[model samples]
Target: MRDRFLTGLIGYPIAHSAAPAMHEAAAAALGVRVHYQLIEVEGAGRDDLRAMLEGIRRLGFAGVNVTFPYKEAVVELLDDLAPDARAIGAVNTIVSDGARLVGHNTDATGFARAIAPLLASAPRGPIALIGAGGVGKAIAFALAGLGVGELRIFDADAARVARLAGQLAGRHPVRGVASIEAALDGATGVVNATPVGMLPSRDSPVPDSLLHPSMWVADAVYTPLWTPLLSAAKAKGAKVLTGRDLAIYAAADAFELFTTMMPSTDVMANAFDAVMAARYSPPA
Candidate 1:
């Protein structure tokens, strides 16, 4: 049998994802062969998810990246969880070990790596975070571990925000605020963890008026790269962090989990940029 690895991403609406190119390029840089596919699982029920996981195992997938809607749910289907994944209550990466399926959360580490430089100079104070779902939960834990003194979380679903805040309270001072304005109050760094600024619609979670030049802003939406929130923050003269770095770092971590080897992240990043340019640039 040929020695090659197989992997893919599991998510609804994954047509716009850049993961395939990023991982495949990393595999190339590592001098290994990997086939990455997109397994769109929109409208899938628990049974469907279980069946899909079974199919992945039968097909000998090295691992798969979980995104949106399924990150938390996938935890229940796994045989084991990494300590951090269990603590954060989400899994963005899953690895297959013989008959065992293990889950891990690269999002937390990825977010920390992406935004550490920006937070280095800023004082330890309140950080405003919007959204409390899968990706949001991971980012919250990451920020808390990075020494964010306070976390102000807001979500349209108050219950989600409250739940996330409760989970994070032991590590950092967390508050589930009722409104975005309340979350931003006394905040020096702002993060948009929701899907508000993704493709199709150009809406941003935070308005330009709410952003200040003194604050640093970040968004988790990367399909468009320059998301509406990032644009508004840039216009307001605020330092901005795009979702691109988070995507790259997360995928790099997942790549290591799958292959048990470190891939050239710089090569993966260049591949992501090339893919984006090919998709977004005007045709000749």
Candidate 2:
């Protein structure tokens, strides 16, 4: 490796993130050293985010993972956006390409890679996608790429769903539903992309009544891994997918993009699990 490199994540309430553990383990597996810092900013506005990105470039940091509310907003702050990021209208991984900061949407590719196996044997009927924000948009595009038959999307901000629907207009069959009930109606599976079930929050996007034994559930909140939404769905006998898979795959993709080094996803996955397990470990 060319000396030691620095990478990071930028998001609010990110104290629960496992990016550092996963990245560090992957680098160690490759005999390379890295420092993956978590840059947590609770209420950063556009100007604050711009300054942060500027600092990343000036400091010569490899790249950073953009998360939560900032992923969609950071698109305009970058010098250039990769084809996937531009198409999805979101950026989860931002790398410095020479002098320009280039944005990429690994969440889309990562979600697609993580969810494919789960959907293989499940019903091909319409799937319900909750939340149309940054991660939601990425998942929506990922579903389309997976060749899902139909997607019904719902978000509290109707305008966000409308824009996401518009983006996938000719690409896939998508409906911008008005209510969560409409989105989950007769769907094959449901994806909770909202931050409702994250740590310190017990809320779930869909009420327990909406979940049934036939539907498979996927939640994007991995801080707690076993989100309430996934729990409710599992209680109903629905096959559940954890946010951990998406987190690991997405982090691995970002690491490779930043360092041009292929990493062992298996090693990253082990690191992810160890961190999550330690969260509940009794302190000595």
Candidate 3:
């Protein structure tokens, strides 16, 4: 394996992502070297994204993690897609084998690992999933892989919701609901796959009235790990899962793909904690 690896993460408005810290710490712990870059841009249309992917190839980056808006859009620009990426219809990680750019969806695997224990003794089926974009698709597929009896999905974008439901057709039990209430009704658990509770947005996607202590609630926004949604869920005595675990696991999976060596999740978690603390700390 190469001693030094150059990798990065591609996403929009990613001024605060802790991915670099997590990956670099993992590399150091494993006795390898890695330089992780943040390729963030604002208002990037399709053409701009194409140019960025071309730049990655030309710059000879080992691999990159795709997030948010780019995870789904980047799939078409890659030379090939791993089986899981194709199945999930999204790409969260991309690697270069010196010849081909292969897209993979580590979000699915990461989420599976992160949420597995939560579902181990709890109800796993008939869950409500908010948001239907890139990460949402990966989460839906992950839930399916975990043998979720059914997924009730809702998205503000009507067309996007339809697209996701269609993709999961024949593969698992999924249905696109008209509203958050529809998705949460009779559900045993709920997951917030949207960016509603992320930094700069303090709103909860689901109303507190809709939440119950019997349900387990999860949010995929880690910027403020304790999102408004999770807070409300906690207030209701519902078991909550933070986006922090998801972020760590996903980055660890990507790091392994880039370095061909698995990383210690505990070390990655420590790195993530340190970075998050610094990001929120006041300048001295």
Candidate 4:
């Protein structure tokens, strides 16, 4: 096992991230010392990202986790990508060897691990997936790999939905629908992959009326753990899964990739929960 390592995360608006604490705790549990920094390159464009990546390599970073607004953008910047990252069209974790940087998509497996307990059996019913951006794409691939019968996708950008459906057509039954209602038509599960329900916003991507008691709901927004979507779904008697599990699972995988050592899920999860509770808890 590596005695020491340096890792970090790159993204815009990363002030809300609990990744540093989570990664440090995981490293400690693995008997390693990891200094995980928050590289907040807000409002950075493609060229800026290239410079940032080069800088990290020169600075001897083990690797960096790429987050929102940069997951897809980092794909072209990497020297190579793991098969899953290539297939998912997103890279959430990058590993730097002295020679070159390689990318991986832990989000797919992370989502699968997070949603495992929520699924009593492999579902064969269509799933309503909203949003087709980076995280949405990863979740789409994860659900497909989970043996979902069909994926009904809806995105504000029609072309985004078409591209995602086309990318996934060979592996699963996918449909690019015109509206959320159409996506939810025969779906037994609903996932909100959009940022509509994230921090500072009280809105839900799926309207309460559209949510039914029979459907199980999941949200990728962990900032507000009980997102409006999950709240509404719970109110309707629907089974619910939050993004916290996904975050912890993804962090564990990223930690492993960065350090070449497995991380303790329990330690990482506890660290994440503590950070979120401290930051988001009301002032006493």
TM-score of each: 0.97, 0.98, 0.96, 0.97
What residue pairs are clashing in model 2?
A: none
Q: State the TM-score for model 4.
A: 0.97
Off by over 4 Å in 1: 1-3
How well is each residue in 48-108 modelled by candidate 4, as lDDT tens digits? Answer: 9999999888889999999888999999999999999999899999999866999998889
- Deviation from native of the Cα of residue 1 in model 2, angstroms: 4.8
Clashing residue pairs for model 1: none
Alpha-carbon RMSD of each model: 1.3, 1.1, 1.4, 1.2
Candidate 4: stretches off by over 4 Å: 121-123
Order of candidate numbers by lDDT, starting with the best:
2, 3, 1, 4
What's the lDDT for all of these models? 0.90, 0.92, 0.90, 0.90
lDDT of 4: 0.90
* TM-score: model 3 vs. ground truth: 0.96
- Candidate 3, residue 236: Cα displacement in angstroms equals 0.9
* Global CA lDDT computed for model 1: 0.90
lDDT of 3 by residue, 1-284 (tens): 57899999888778889998899999999899899999987777889988888777878788888887788888888899999999878898999876679999888888999999999878755999999989999999999889977899999999999999999999899999999999999899999999998989999999999999899999999989899999999999999999989999999999989989999999999999998888887899
Per-residue CA lDDT of model 1 for 1-284, tens digit only, reads 33478999999889988899998888887778989989997888789999988988888999899998899888898899999999989999989865888999999999999999989976667899999999999999999898876889999999998789889877788999999999888789999999898898799888678898889999988989999999989999989999999999999999999988898889989998998899888999
